[model samples]
Target chain A: MEMSALWKLSYGMYAIGTLDGERPTGCIVNTVIQITSDNPVIAISMNKNNYTYDCIKRTGRFSVSILSEKTTQNVIAKLGFSSGRDTDKFDGDIFAWEYMDGLPVVNENSCAHITAEVITMTEMETHYVILARVQDAKVTSDYNPMTYKYYHEVIKGKAPKNAPTYQAPEKITDKETWACQICGYIYEGDLTKEPEDFVCPICKQPKSMFKKQ
Target chain B: MEMSALWKLSYGMYAIGTLDGERPTGCIVNTVIQITSDNPVIAISMNKNNYTYDCIKRTGRFSVSILSEKTTQNVIAKLGFSSGRDTDKFDGDIFAWEYMDGLPVVNENSCAHITAEVITMTEMETHYVILARVQDAKVTSDYNPMTYKYYHEVIKGKAPKNAPTYQAPEKITDKETWACQICGYIYEGDLTKEPEDFVCPICKQPKSMFKKQ
Candidate 1:
């Protein structure tokens, strides 16, 4: 079986929002699918190990922030690359966000959002297929929703290890590269030639966070 | 609740293949999502009324032909516009297709296909959420997969009523148009103006099949 074939399956990137106690937390996912139209229900696959999955299980509610092409790589780095258990994903006022139905939705370059209540959840070996009923939804912007293909081919981003689509890194040989230790943004060529103030383009992390990969 | 907000959720077009007794049958859908990467499982939302759903229930297996940007509108009209219960979807040599793992996969303009076995299913009011384990899969082309947004805005195709995502027809304001009775393809001008030989651009059905809208 050609595992690469699975990459052809298209998906949209999303910031799944939920609350950890009174604190808002979430993670990025690509497996949200609308299963029913009337009383619209959506199913999202979340890794069991994800901190956001535990938050959703406790709160029994979640929100979907539909990421669009305008969403910056920093938003992905803040929400997707880091774990909520270790640090506040929304700290430092990194993402311009707002509260909707008591759930915090990352509004930076998001086109729409849906607040949902967990109706049921089926446990998979590696993930939880959580089915949620849409409680309320709103269109945030008119920008086109970003497809996973666009994220990979255009933004040149890689999936986080917690993502269901995550694959082990393949050996890279294009040039000497510096990769962000926080997010996996690759910086091509010599890092020493850059200015002292330079930071990771995607994660906005200082040069100290980059390591030769 | 803004129903249009649901439109912001992105999706990919796929031709779902299954078996009718010993014959091959399938339909087009936009709700296939990979649920897990390890051992790679997927879930597809199919309306209970669809013939392909019944086929999968009985056969316990199906294939997903990932349609790419290169896929023609005719392929969507064939598998999407017609009923697999009576019509031979694979008949009339409509698509250049072949079998993979004893399942017919529509190859024309397909980027990849996954043959799967249904492990379990949850029945909703109008649809069934089927969880299937990947038996085998292959990448057929390197072309980018066609997204549902591209199908609507670029290909100008409309969804069949049976689709969970189908929206009610919008009020039309253009010069009197004719629509295909089978595929709902709108002809911008008078169908009578074209030669009698002219057929529906999407379904290729004769002019007699058009109805003034």
Candidate 2:
């Protein structure tokens, strides 16, 4: 199979929020689909290794925050590039949220927010397909929901390694570049020339996280 | 739940082709999602009542034609608006296709085509979520794939009742108009002023199929 052909499949960006014990934790995903209309059901594919996946599996509840073009990359960097097991994803007020039935939902730059209870899960080798019935949902903003394609081409974002739709690393040119060890954000320049305080703009990782590539 | 919030979920438009006994049959869908990257797997939700859904259940193999913005609206009108059980969708050459592993794949205005064998199915009250592993796939064009948002706002297409994503009919403006009973193409202004041979531009159905709304 020519795997790149799958790129034609469209998807929206979303932050799946669930709690790890009492801590608000989540990660980014792009495979959410509305399955049924009446008492609508939604399906989202989460990699088995995702910390948020374990949280949802345990709690049986999750909330989806639909990210839009206006969304800051920091939200993705904090929740997506880093593991919720080691990081407090809701820290430093990177995203605004309100707790709904003990679940945190990020409303900043969100087109909509949906809370659902897991009804079923179809297990795959690397991922678990979670089917949830929408319990409560609301439109948060009129901003256009960010498309995965837009995230790549417009925002120049890279997918987290654990993302189900993650593609293998692409061939890089012979240009001097510094790549983020965490998020793989390629800084196309001579990194040594920049100040030590420089950090990965996409993932907000420190300069020490940069690897010459 | 505010179901309208679900509308923010993005999806690509597709022509789902499968065999109905010995005849080639298909329908339009916007729910196809790639679940895995390695040995790619795809999942599509089909309303249980749809004829094409039954066909896929029997055939065990199906092809997905990723529709592009350039796709003719008639492809959707024929495959989406009309029932394959009653209409020979491929008879009128409404779409261009070829046989792939004995499954019909429409390639006209398609960004890609994927042939898959059913791995399993998740049963829901109103739909069946078919998970299939990609057996063969090819990128056919460089055209931008048609998104469901573009299909609705740009193509002005209405969802067929059998579609899993089908929404209730939107309120129509009170005006002198005639709508095609077959495909819901509304013709504004006095319908009586049109020629006797007037037909729904999208569905190619005759004026007799129109009803004042």
Candidate 1 lDDT by residue in tens digits, B34-78: 888889899999988999999999999999999987776657888
Task: Please give, for residues A42-104, the per-residue lDDT of candidate 1 as tens digits.
Answer: 889899999999999899999999998777666787788878898688766556998999998
DockQ, cand. 2: 0.38
Off by over 4 Å in 2: A157-204, A208-213, B157-204, B208-213
Question: What lDDT score is found at residue B194 in candidate 2?
Answer: 88
Worst 10 residues of 2 chain A by lDDT: A164-173
Taking the tens digit of each residue's C-alpha lDDT, what string does model 2 give over B36-130?
88888889999988999999999999999998877756567777887887878777554577888888888777899899999999988788899
The CAPRI quality class of candidate 2 comes to: acceptable
- Best of the candidates, DockQ: 2
* All models, RMSD in angstroms: 8.6, 8.5
Tens digits of per-residue lDDT for model 2, A58-160: 9999999999877755567667888888878887755577886678988777899899999999888888899999899998889878888878865553545
